[model samples]
Target: EPEVTQTPSHQVTQMGQEVILRCVPISNHLYFYWYRQILGQKVEFLVSFYNNEISEKSEIFDDQFSVERPDGSNFTLKIRSTKLEDSAMYFCAGKNGQRSTDTQYFGPGTRLTVL
Candidate 1:
């Protein structure tokens, strides 16, 4: 089965830096989303993109964050400036549509660590 893949399963960065988390979503999937789990906290939705534009976004998606489908198969999330609070496991997810209650398949996640 096709699956979402993320790079650099683990990353260590300073408190004020830039990071680009990469993801390759399922080939045939159309809906893409980004979610983050801060250690033991609940998984919070960051943003959702479809048809080359944002479909839905949560408040957590602040000015420092951005996302794009750089090409047919690659989806990326860029953080302009990192903060201590930004350290979390970022998960990339993709879904076909809402036909089946919008089930999202998540990647193993890229664990971001800030010091």
Candidate 2:
């Protein structure tokens, strides 16, 4: 079975530092997304990407954040400047392009700790 994969499983950064998190989704998936769960909070969608452009985004994906599919296999999220409030577990998810009702498969998540 295919699954989503993320790198740098954990990261710690200073308040003003930039951070980039990476992920690789199941090969046949066509939709990709980023979601975050602030410590003790529910998971919230940040953005969605398809056809190599952003398809949808939430209020949380402000100017400080960006997403990219640098290549055929990798998707990434970058924070221009980290904030203590940004500390959370960031998840990368995807769903197969062939199935409109397919459940999204989520990566294990990258834990970001901003100080």
Listed in order, each prediction's TM-score against the native is 0.95, 0.95
Per-residue lDDT for 11-86 in model 1, tens only? 8999889999999998888999999999989999999999988899999899999999978788999998899999
Name the candidate that leads on lDDT: 2
**For model 1, what is the C-alpha lDDT against the true structure?**
0.92
Residue pairs whose backbone atoms clash in candidate 2: none
Check candidate 1 and list the clashing pairs: none
**Where does candidate 2 stray beyond 4 Å?**
98-100
lDDT of 2 by residue, 72-91 (tens): 89999999999999999999
Cα lDDT computed for each candidate against the true fold: 0.92, 0.94
Cα error of candidate 2 at position 24, Å: 0.7
